[model samples]
Structures are given as C-alpha cells and as structure tokens.
Target: MVRFVDVPRMRHWVEERGVETVIRGIAERIESDFRRWPEFDTQARVASHSPGGVVELMPVSDSRRYSFKFVNGHPGNPAAGLQTVTAFGVLADVASGYPVLWSEMTILTALRTAATSALIARTLARPDSQVMALIGTGSQAEFQALAFRALLGIDSVRIWDTDPRAMDTFERNMRPLGFSVHRASDGAEACDGADIVTTCTADKAYATVLTDDMVRPGMHVNAIGGDCPGKTELEAAILHRADVFVEYPEQTRIEGEIQQLPEDFPVTELWRVLRGEEPGRTSAEQITVFDSVGFAIEDYSALCYLDSDLGEGEAADVDLIAEPADPKDLFALVAAGANSTVRLG
Candidate 1:
C-alpha cells in the first residue's frame, strides 16, 4: 500500500497545520536540501509546449529517495473555468523502486513555490525589508503574501493586476488575514515605495509587466511567473542592472526571465549561495533578483516534508503496486486471475 494525499486530505492537512506553518516547514526543508546541493541529481524539467501552454515533468533523486511532479501551465484555462496550473507528484524509495508517497501537488506546489521565494528573499532581500509590491494577484498571490509574512515579517502589500477582479480577489482574501492590502492602479504604482517586489503574472508571452524604471536599488525582485520559453515578466534592462540568482541555470536559460538575455549573460545558482560557496547580498544598495522557474528538487523537498509530517492513519493507503507471490513470477500472478470474468469482442 502506498500513502496518498488526495486533494481533500491535502486541504485538510493545510488547514489543520495552518498555511504559514506549512510554508515555514517546507522552507526549512528546502533550505536543508539546498545546503546539501551536491548530493542530489539535478537537471532541467522535460517540457512539452503547444500554442495553448506547456506540460512538464520535473524529476530528481537523492541517494535515498526519488521524486517527480507532473504539472501543466495553461493560461487560457481560467476563461474556460479551469485552473491555470495543476499538478500531482510522487516520492519513491530508491532501493525498492516503489513509490512511498503520492500527493496532489497543485496545493503543494503553491506552498513550496511560496516557501522557495521567501527562502531566497531571506538571504537575498535586505533584512529590514517590510513592504512587498505584488504585481500579479492570481491564485499564487495570496500564498506568496502569506509566505513572506511568515518568513520575513512582511504584512504590508501593495498590489496590482491587469484585471481589477484579480486585485479585488487579492484584497478580499488578504485583508481579513490582517495584511495591509492596498490596491494600486498599475505595476509602477504597486512597486512604489515597496522593499520587495514579486511579479507572478500568468501570460504566456513576452509582456513587460515590470519595467526597468520601476525597480530601484536595494530591491529584491521575486520573478516567479516567467517560467516558460516564451514567457517573461521583467524588462531585460532590469536583468542587466541586478545580480540574478536562479535555481538551475540550464533550465532558467530556457524558461526564466533570463531567457530574454543572451546565453553568455552571467547568473549565480541559488544553491551556491545557500551552500555558502558564493555570496548573496553584498550591500544594502545592491539589487537582487530571484529568477524562480520552479525546479524538481523543490518538489523533492516538499514531498519529503509532507512524508515526514504524516502521522499514523493521517493519509489514505492505496494499493497502487502489483505484488506477486514471487518477484520473478509475474506471469503466474496474471494466470491466477485468468479465471476472472472477461468480455471479449
């Protein structure tokens, strides 16, 4: 039997533990895994793109366990009354080659993504930063706000979106949670006087949601939306001015905001900074940008974190794998079931 955290159970888990606590826990796990970055197998996610959007398979493994997430990004889904992004993931035991845990990663991905952003901000953003400018108020906006609040003590947010309904949703969701939510007229208005700027728009094109003029010195830009080949959020001039940090350069060069720049453009892998092999923010006046294009290792960490938090009977057990009496007698097991009813055409 394999442990499965279906959508309902996952929601229950989040509600019981509280969203901020779960984000903080996942952040701790992500930080711990990043510190031992050299130990895991890493690579770019395999993606299939179409005019509509993209579907991706992100896989990674440590010596003990392996994990992968099946995810999709379709910007047009919302108009059709579907989620723009959705996912599920699995963690398997390396030795047995059997899946130990399976989870609905739609919620887990949001939590982990927010955790990752906050984790990077802790190192890259200035220590005294308080206010955050959220440029996109989609499904991810609230999670990002909560994660920053939990990790960085940021309770004030200035928000904007091309669609006023999105901004209204953000205000409706965040205001009751004790966050000081201010709806801005535009991206620049949202970014004005803010310490940290997070852009998470879902358009699958080269839209400059954040211009160069809006970004000031000492600001940390968490660009999480520009996560595909043709998708980007910030202007190229901003990349030139800031010190860009990424999860995996090979992947980021193909899918992140840095894709707008040349191949030879410089970037620092976030693991290096987390491992103390490279410097993070050197001065308060420096601009730091985390070009997060979500990686497989983060899913690995989230799966591990979820697995660790499971108590006895907390999750459902599903018989997901076939077990024969003898490992090499798989045919015999099938033959035993041959007597079962079957309808043939």
Candidate 2:
C-alpha cells in the first residue's frame, strides 16, 4: 500500500501546523540538500511542449529513494477556471522499486518554490535587505512575499502585474499576513527601492519584466518566471551585469534567464555557495542573480520533507501498488481477483 497525502489532506496538514512552519522547515531541507548536492543523481527536467502549454517530468534520486513530480504549466488555465500550475508527486524506495508515498504537489510546489527562493536569497542577498519587489502577482506572488518575511525578515513588498484583479488578490492575501503591501504602476516602479527583486510572471515569452536600469547594485534578483524555452523575465543586460548563480547550469541555460547569455558565460552553481565551496555575495555592492528555473532535486527534497511528516495527522493509505502474494507469481494474484470484479455486465 502507498501512503497518500491528497489535496484536501495536504491542505489540512498545513493548516494544522501553519504554512509558515512548513515554509521554514522546507527551507532548511532545501539548504541541507544543496549542501550535499553531489550525493544525488541530478538532471535537467524533461519537457514536452505543445501549443497549449508544456508538461514536464522532474526526477531525482539519492541512493535510498527516488522521486518525481508530474506537472504542467498553462498560462491560460486561469481563464478556463483552472490553476495555471497543478502537480502530484511520488516517492519510491530505490532498492525495492516500489512506491512508498504519494502526495499532491500543487500547493506543495508553491511552498517549495518560495522556500527555495528564500533559501537562496538567505545566502545571496545582503544581510540588511528588507524590501522585496514582486513583479508578478499571480499564484506565486503571495508565497514569495511570505517566504521572504519568514526567512529573511522582509516586511515590505512592492507589487505589480498586468492584471489589476490579480494584484488585488495578492494584496488582499498578503496584507492580512503582516506585509506592508504597495501597489506599483508598472514593473519598474515595483523594483524601485526594493532590496530583492523577484520576477515570477507566467507569460510564455521572452519579455523583459526587469531591465538593467531597474536592477541596482547590492540587490539579489530571484528570477522565477522564465522556466522554459523562449520564456524569460529579465533583460539580458541585467544578467550580464549581475554575478549569476543557478541550481543547474545545463537546465538554466535551456529554461532560465541565463539562456539569453553566451554559452560560455560564467555561472556558479548555487550548491557550490551552499557548500561553502564558492563565494555567494563577494561584496556589499555586488549584484547577484539566482536564475531559478525550478529543478528536480527541489521536488525530491520536498517529497522527503513531506514523507517524514507522515502520521503527524490524518493520512490516507492508497492501494496504488499491487502486492502479489507470491512475488514470482504476479499473474496468479491478478487471476484470483479477476473473477467477480471482472464480470461482464
């Protein structure tokens, strides 16, 4: 039997412990994993793109367990009364090759994404950074605000988006949580006076949401929206002027803002900084860019974090795997159960 943390159960679990606790916990996990990044198998995620959107499978594993997340990104989903991003993931034992835990990842993705950004910002951003410019106020905007507050002591957020209603939703959601929210007239306005600039827009185009002028010295830019081919948020000049860091250089080259740069352009893998193998922010005036194109290892870490929290509250067991009485005679178990259950109506 596979233990399951379905959508409703996952929501209840977060509510029981509170989202801030979950964010802080997952941030710790991400930091720990990044420190020992070479111990796990890593790869760029495989994606299938269509006219509608893109579907992706992100897989990563350590020696003991393997995990994968199935997710899709469709910017038009909100107009269709659906989420722009939805996901579910499975964690399996490597030796047995059998799934152990399965969980809904739509909400978990938001949490992990925010946790990841915060974790990286903790290392790259200046210690005195207190304000964040949220350039996209979609499903991810509020979480990013919360994560910065929980992890980095950021209390003020200057926000903007093409949709007024989305900005309204973001302000309504974030203000109650203690953030001093300010609505900006445009992306440049939002970036003004912000210590950290986060661009998480969802348009599948190479749009310059943040130009070089918008980025100031000593600022860390968390670019999370340009996560696929032809999708980018920052102006290429911004990346040229910043000391760039990434989760995986290969993946980021294809799906992150770094794609706009020359193939040989310098980049430091974020793990190196986490491991103290490389410098994060070399000076108080240095600009740093975390070209965040969500990686598979993050999903792996999130699943591990969720799996460890099992039995803390109500969790459901799902018969997702077949348990054959005789491991060698898998056909026999299926034959035995096929009688009344397979009756022709």
Candidate 3:
C-alpha cells in the first residue's frame, strides 16, 4: 500500500521530536558514509527550470534503501496564497523499487536545511563560535535559527532581510524560544563581524548578498541559496578568497558556488573532512565556505532515520492506493471499495 502523510501530520512529526533525531542521525550517517565514501550512488540533482520556477529531483541510495524528493521553488506563490515552495518525497525499497512511504516535505525542507547548516558548522566553524548572521528572513529563517541554537551553541543572530515583514514573521515565530535576536538594515550589515554567516535568500537571480569586502577571516559561510542553475548569492570574488567545502564535489561543481568557477577549480568535500582525509581549516584566519546546494543523501539519511525512530512504528498511515487481493484482478479492489450502501441518490 502507498501510504500518505500530509503537511500537518509531517509538521507534528518533525517539530515534536522527529526532526532533531533525524538531523543527529544524518550527521552520524554522513560521517560513516564518508568513511566509506565510495559505497553509495551519488550525482548532481536533476532540475527542470521554467519561468514560473524550478522543480528538482534529488535521488540517492545506499545498499539498503532509496529515496527521492520532488520539490519546487516559486517566489511569487505567496501572492497566490500558497507558499514559496511546496514539496513531497518518497521512500522506496531499493531491491524492487517499490515505494514504501510518502510524506509532505515543506516543513521537512526547512528542518533539513537548518539541520545541514548546523551540522556543517559543527565541523568547520570555530570551536568557540556562538554567534551567527542570518540573511534573508522568510519561512526558512526561524527554522535556521532554531536549528543553530539547538545543534550548535549559537546564542545570537544579526537578522536582516529585504522584506521587513519577513523579519517580523521570523521574530514572531521565534518568540517562545528566547534568543538574542538583533535586526540589521541589510545583508552586509547582518554578515559583518559574525563567526558564521548563513545565506538563505529566496531570489532566483544572480544577486550578490555578500561581497568580498564584507567577509572577515575565519568566518564560516553556510550558503543555502544559489542552489539552482542561475541563482547565486556570494560574489564570484568570494569563492576565490575562501577555502570551499561542499557536500558532494560532483554535484556542487555543477549546482553550487563552484559553478561560477572553471572546470578545474579546486574544492574540498565535507565527507573528506569528516573522514579525516582532509583538514577543515588549518588556521583561525582561514576562511571556510560550505557551498550548500542540498543533497539527496541527506534526505535519504533523514527518511531512514525517521522510519527507524518513529516509536514502535507509530506514524499514521493512510491507504493512498487501491489494494487488490488477486494480483491480476486490478479493477476488483476499486470496484469493491466504490460500492456504497448509504448513497444519497
């Protein structure tokens, strides 16, 4: 049976307990996957970009299971009373390619991105770093802040956005959990003198949110935007100046900040650092960049983690597909379930 978990159900599952556990699990899984980096299938995300927005497919699998997410980004959607992005994903059996579970991923995206940011910072950011700069306040802003506060020891953020209303929404959502949140006038102002600078802007164009002039030595950047083909945040100059780290080199090279660089441009994979095959940052003065175009492996890691820790298989499941008792009688189940004795007609 194909099971369905809607957005509300997913939100409860994630916000209540599932998200933190999945993030921690992914961090551990990533570490182990990196230790044996050659074992799994990895590739650049498949994208279909249109004038309306972009839809992307991220697929990844190990020997055990496979997963994929179908996600789209449309900034103008808010005007239509929908979100900027809406998503759903599937978890499937690797051996037979049969879908095992499906869930809404709008909230999951926010959680996983934040989780990834925090995970990368834990590895590359300075040990004593407790402050961060969050540019682009939107639906994702609060999640990023909470994830950092939970995963790292982040205590403060200089928040800035092109839209003050977004900042207001972010601030309001975060009121219950107290943090030293300060507002900044612009992206550069937010990034100034920060230990970790996170960029989560939603624009689909090439906009330079951070110039080389804004960067301080030893700062760790979690570049979350510039994920698609034409979108980018940091100026190309910043790439030249920073020592870059990425989730997967093959994917990052085509989809991440390195897309701006030459074919032979050098960058380090985060797994290598996690695996101790490469150094994170050699000195306090060295700039570190995490060109984060989200990866499918992270999502796969998340789903398996959720599946395992859902407490005695307690996640609600709904029959989203017709089940036939006889394998060849495809129409029987639909016909049987359709007959109703209480029809008003």
| Global Cα lDDT for candidate 3 | 0.80
Off by over 4 Å in 3: 18-22, 34-36, 312-314, 320-345
List clash counts for every candidate, in order.
0, 0, 0
**Roughly what TM-score does model 3 have, to 2 decimal places?**
0.90
The candidate maximizing TM-score is: 1
Clashes of 1: 0
lDDT score for residue 48 of model 1: 91
- Model 1, runs deviating above 4 Å: 336-345
For each candidate in turn, give its C-alpha RMSD to the true structure in angstroms.
Answer: 1.9, 2.5, 4.3
Among all windows of 10 consecutive residues in model 2, the one with the lowest summed lDDT is 336-345
Query: Lowest summed lDDT over 10 consecutive residues: which window, candidate 3?
Result: 306-315
- How does residue 59 of candidate 1 score in lDDT? 95
lDDT of 1 by residue, 18-41 (tens): 999999999999999998988999
Cα lDDT computed for each candidate against the true fold: 0.95, 0.91, 0.80
lDDT of model 1, residue 305: 99
